[model samples]
Target: MDRLIVMKTFVTVAKSSSFSAAARELAISGSLVSRHVADLERQVGVRLVNRTARSVSLTDAGTRYADFARRILSEIDEEDTALSESRDRPEGTLSVICPKWIGTLDLGDAIAAFVKAHPLITMRFELGGMSDRNYDFLERGYDVAFHTRDLRDSNVLVRRVSELPFVLVAAADYVRRHGAPTTTAELAEHQCILHPNDPVWRLGAGAETSHHKVQHPSVVANSYLVIEKLVEQGAGIALIPRRPAVERLASGDLVEVLPQHQPPARALYAVHGPGGHTPERVRIFLDFMTVWFRSRPAAHAA
Candidate 1:
C-alpha cells in the first residue's frame, strides 16, 4: 500500500466521518475506504475508529493519528509544490512584515507596484508588531521583512534598500506659541512629540550627536504618523520623516527647525533568512526592491 495514499484516504474518512462520504470524495468504493482505514489501524496497532449502525466517529487514538496524518500530508504537498515551482515559474504566496510607520509612510507605493507587476505572487503585507529578535520572521513564517534599525545579527541576510531622511518640524503656530530652540539642549525645555521606540531623540550629525530625552512630551505615541499629526496640529515639536511631511512643510503648515543639527538618515534594509537555496519569490522581491529604491531620488530620501 502506498503510505501517502493510505494517509490521504484516512484523512478523508476522518473529515467526512462516514466511509461512504469519503469514498464518494476519493472516487472509490466504500469498502476500499474501510479497508484503507483498517489497514492504517492495523499498521498502527490501534483501533482508529469506532463505528455504530448509523454513524462512524474517531476514537481518542484515531483523533490524534488523524491530526498527525493531516500535518504530514500538508507538508508533503507543500514540498512537492515547492519543487515544482523551482522547475517551472515564480508563483507562490509571499508573506511580508514591516513596521507600521514605514508601511504607511514610504513602503505603500512599492508594495502596490510589486503586487501589480507580479500577478502570480499573492502578497500578505502585515504591518505592526515586528519583533526585535533576530530571525523571528522564520518562526513567524514570514518570507521577508523590512527593517530600519541597526541589526546586530549576522545570521540573517540584510540588503540596504533605501535611506530616509528625518526632519525636525513643528507647526508655525506651535513655534509661534512655544518658540523654536537654537540648540538640542533646549528641546528638553520644550514639549516634544515622540515615538516610543525612539523617545530619546539623537540630534545633530556625526560626532555632534547629542541625545535629548523627551523630558516633557505633550504627546507620546509609538507611531510616526500619529506623532507627525500631533506636531501638525500644533500640539508640539517632533522629529519626523520628511517625505510624508513634505507637502505640509512646503505649505508652511510645518517648518523645519534646527536645520544645521539634523538627525542621521534612517537606513531601510531588506531582511531575509540566512544562506540557503533562496526561493524564487524572495529572490524576485529583493531584486524588485533594489531596482525600485535605486530609481528613487536619494536627495529626496536623504
Candidate 2:
C-alpha cells in the first residue's frame, strides 16, 4: 500500500471512528479501508485503532499518530497549493469550532461577515460539538477553536480575543414578586438560574469580589440564550452574557440584580495549534474575529 494513501485513509478512519464511514468518505470499500489501516498499523508496528464489534476508537498511540498525520497531510497540501499558486494571498479551507451559544449570537454574524469578505478562503464553522476532553479540536480536524475561559494547554497559542461581560439579571415582575437581592450574599436566598459550567457565580472585581454558590436554582441550563429566556419569563435570576442580554435589559424585559457587584468580564480567547507553522488563512481569521468583537458594544450594564 502507498504510504501516503495509507496515512490519509488511517486519518479518515480515526476521524470518522468507523471503517464504513471512512470508506464512504473516501469512496472506497470498507474492507479496503480496513486493509489500509492494518497496513499502516503494521508499518508503524502498533495497533492504531482498538476495534470492537460495536465501536472503534483510537488507542493512545493512534491518538498521537493522528495528530502528526493531520499536521503532515495539512502541510503537504499547503505546499502543493503553494507550488501551484502564489502563497501571498490566503486561500484553502479554514475550519473553526465554537460553543453553541456563541454561534447563535453576534459571533455568528461576525463569522458570516468574515467569510463574505474573504472570498478566497473556504470557511468550515462548526457550531458546538466540542468534547469535555482537553484540546479535542486538534485531533478532530479543526484549524482553530474559540473558548470563553482561559485554556491551560501549552501546545496551543492562546490569544485574548475580547471580554465577554455578563450581568446577573431578573424580570421586573419576578423582582417585584421575589424582591431583589441587594448583595452577593443575598443571592443565596433567591431563586437563581444555574449555568451548568458556572454553578458558583463569582461577582465583583479585585478585593471586593465574592463567590455565591447558586442556591435554590429553579432551572439549570447549558445555553446562556436559553437561560436569558427563562429569566425573562420570571423563572429565576441568571448571569447572562452582555451582548445577548443588552436589548432585553434596555427594554426593561430584564433588570440587573445588584448592579454594584460587577463581576470581572469573562475573557474570550482564540486558541489554535502553535503559531509558527499555522496557515495564513487561520491567522487572518483569528485577527479578523478579534477586531470585529472589539468593535461591538461591550459591558452592557446600565
Candidate 3:
C-alpha cells in the first residue's frame, strides 16, 4: 500500500477511534481500514492501536505518531491549497527569451505594460542568445520563448499571438530623386540599404515570392531602427516590419517601392513547455501580449 494512503487511513481511524467509523468516513470496507492500520503500524515498526470488544484506543507511541501525522497531513493540505489558489492569482517570476531584433522592436512596450499591470509577476526578459532549437529555452529555465516563424517542434506548445507584416519601403524623396524600382531586378541598379544579418531580401508572397540577394549596398546595419532612420534620410529602399514603418508610411515620409507585390507576413508566436498545465504567469503574459498586439493599429492594418 502507498504510504500516504495508509497514513491517511490511519489518521482517520485515530481521529474517529473506531475502525467502522473510519471505514464509513473513507467509504472503504472495515477490513480494509483494519488492514491499513496494520500496514502502517508494521511500516513504522510499532503498535499504533489497541482494540477491545467494545472500544478502540491508541498506545503512547501511537498518540505521539498520530500527532505528528496529523500535523504533516494538515501542512500538506495547506500547501496544496496555497498552490491551487496561486494558479488563479498568477504570482511568480516569468522568464522569457526572444530574438534581439524582435525584442528591440515594439515587444518591449508590451512587456513594460505587462509588468505594470501585473506587479506580482517578476519579469526576466532576455534579448538574443537564443538557440535554434525551440525547446532549448525550457532547459535553460525559461518559462516562455517568442518566435517570429512557425515552429515544427512537438516538444513545445505554440500560441500564435499576431501576424507581423513587412513592407518594402523607401523615402519619398529618394523615390523622386532616383526613381522607384519597377522590378526586383531593378533593385541592383539602385542603392539598397541592407541589414547584414538578413542579406537576402524577399519580395512578393506564396509561390510568387522572389528572393533577391543584396550583394552591393549603400549602407549596412544590424539594427532595424538604424536602417529605418537611414531609409528616412533617403539613403535607399529597404524592407521593414510594418509596425515600425506604419507611422512613417502614414505621414508620407516613406512610400512603398513595390506596391503590387507583398512580402510574406511572419506570425508572432509565444511558445512554452508542452503540458496541460501552463504556469499562470506564462498564460497571463501571453494573453496580455495577444491583447496588446490586437489593440495596435498596425496589427489591424496587417
CA lDDT for candidate 1: 0.86
Best by TM-score: 3
Candidate 1: segments with Cα more than 4 A from true spot: 1-84, 152-154
How high is the CA lDDT of each candidate model? 0.86, 0.85, 0.89
lDDT of 1 by residue, 90-129 (tens): 6788999998988987688888999999999999999987
Please give the lDDT score at residue 167 for candidate 1: 90
Kindly report which residue stretches of model 3 are placed more than 4 angstroms away from their true locations once superposed. 206-208, 297-302
TM-score for model 2? 0.69
Per-residue alpha-carbon lDDT of model 3 for 204-255, expressed as tens digits? 8887789999889889988888999999999998988888888788889899
**Angstrom error at residue 260, model 2:** 0.6
The C-alpha local distance difference test score for the whole of candidate 3 amounts to 0.89
Candidate with top lDDT is 3
Query: Residue 293 deviation, candidate 3, in Å?
Result: 1.3
In candidate 1, position 271 carries an lDDT of: 90
For each candidate, what TM-score against the reference?
0.70, 0.69, 0.90
